[model samples]
Target chain A: MRERSDDTLETPITSMIDIVFLLIIFFVVTAQVDKDVVDESITLAQAKNAPAIDAVDPRSVTINLNKDGKINVALQPMSISQLQQLLLAMRTQAGSAIPVLIRCDYETQFRHIDRVMQAAASTGLYRVRLIAEATGG
Target chain B: MRRKPPEQLNVPMSSMIDIVFLLLIYFIVTAREEVTEAHLAVNLPAPGVAKASENKPQMMEIEVHPGYLSVRGMRLPIQEIANTLVRLGKNDPDITVLVKVNLSARAEDLVTALDLCSAANLNNLNVVTLK
Candidate 1:
């Protein structure tokens, strides 16, 4: 029978802490940027090879459209007219640099998004990114 | 005779580790959920950027109405839409695909069409409204 050595095994707390911090930092960074695009109340559109969040202008307006084609801006439901007015105001205040991010339910009609796009273009803000669920194995 | 040293104890890391692991799990789950967003970058033509084409570019039309897709006024299965678009794009890379979507149709319907268009490498696509 082999005798066991008496040396105590340390749990490598330093390395564990280092790994923990790295993971937390990664999650924190991702969480920060994704907040603008996701909403539990609205189902996201799913597409193959949808661009990642970073592909979007970080300082962009996020508009959520429910399945019924209802527009949601800044967590509140509003008519498309009101939404347009608000976006126009924002565009004027911020200029063409402020891009718009449209997050609509996958089941939502394209006209819902089309209207929003028309509104953005009318305001001279041409950059628009649509959010969808990416698919791959 | 060797003296038996008193057993030294320190703050238990087990409890702290348990809490941290819990938090780590929470963050991981939330992160996965947040990262599910697959964005489609549709660069709508800037105001005044769309000019009239002197050459009547090849045109293809697609319609969306909830459970079905209509191509060139004929209904086609969604799965085959990409293949058809790809074949069409081969004939003319300058082909323009005009997507007419039902205003009340599902967003998935539009996305499915868009995704297939993209998969076929067709960049000249537009979502139009026939009001």
Candidate 2:
């Protein structure tokens, strides 16, 4: 009787490992580590009419503008002229149609955003995207 | 009484699987919670180039202030701006909405203005810094 109970207590290791491996694969694919890194410090504006971006362009440059008139590109703070030079280099590499996404803080002033816009315009990037929160604040 | 089972030499798969499951759960819980974000597409006027449209459309100038917005010299609250745009858009589909953002205006105010324009289906939008 004890032997039968011990046999039943043995865990099905092979099947458990199989399920674990499958779950790992699912997570790995869904995580999408290649997607653009979002800055946690920026508080984006909430807009109801804004269109949802299903898939962000991998080549697009994300510019984060904080409330203090500071600009962050890839988590590194940069000046307006530096931003312009970076944008120009990107345009030269990816052509004028290269996308630009501006992630401006909700409390930031318009003048700071204007500077970023001017920089993009100088680089021949006509159309740019302004990011907003998906839901109401 | 059952005889003691002979010890078999093999890898400890059960404990390893237990550790793997723990790690997976930890990752699933500690992963960054990404806040879904949307975007509003804007067109910036290229420098040194004039608009080539043969027939210029009627333009509505809207100024964004600190807490309110002024539409064509008439000051209006943020909530009422959408209705005004809708009424104007219905009158003329080709009307261009020119947004002059004040230096003191918050970015949220500009976004609210643009959102209202979009809600009114006013596609021809031009935003410039108010001098």
**Using TM-score as the measure, which candidate wins?**
2
Scored by lDDT, model 1 comes in at 0.71
- Kindly list the per-residue Cα lDDT of model 2 for residues A1-137, writing each as its tens digit: 87788776766656777798789778776765443456678899988876666798889999999999899898888999999999999999999888899999999998899999989998889788888877642
The collision pairs in model 2 are none
Docking quality category of candidate 2 according to DockQ thresholds = acceptable
Residue pair clashes in candidate 1: A45-A133, A106-B108, A107-B106, A107-B107, A108-B107, A132-B38
Q: Please give the fraction of native interface contacts (Cα pairs under 8 Å between A and B) kept by each candidate.
A: 0.74, 0.84
The runs of at least 3 residues in candidate 2 whose Cα sits more than 4 Å from the true structure, single-residue gaps closed, are A1-36, B1-17, B48-55, B91-94
Instruction: Tell me each candidate's TM-score.
Output: 0.69, 0.77
TM-score of 1: 0.69
Q: After superposition on all CA atoms, how large is the RMSD of candidate 2? A: 6.3
What lDDT tens digits, residue by residue, belong to model 1 across residues A1-137? Answer: 12222223434566677788799779778876757545568877678743444465656788988877788776777887888898889887888778687888876777678888888877777667677777742
Worst 10 residues of 1 chain A by lDDT: A1-10
Model 2 local distance difference test score: 0.81
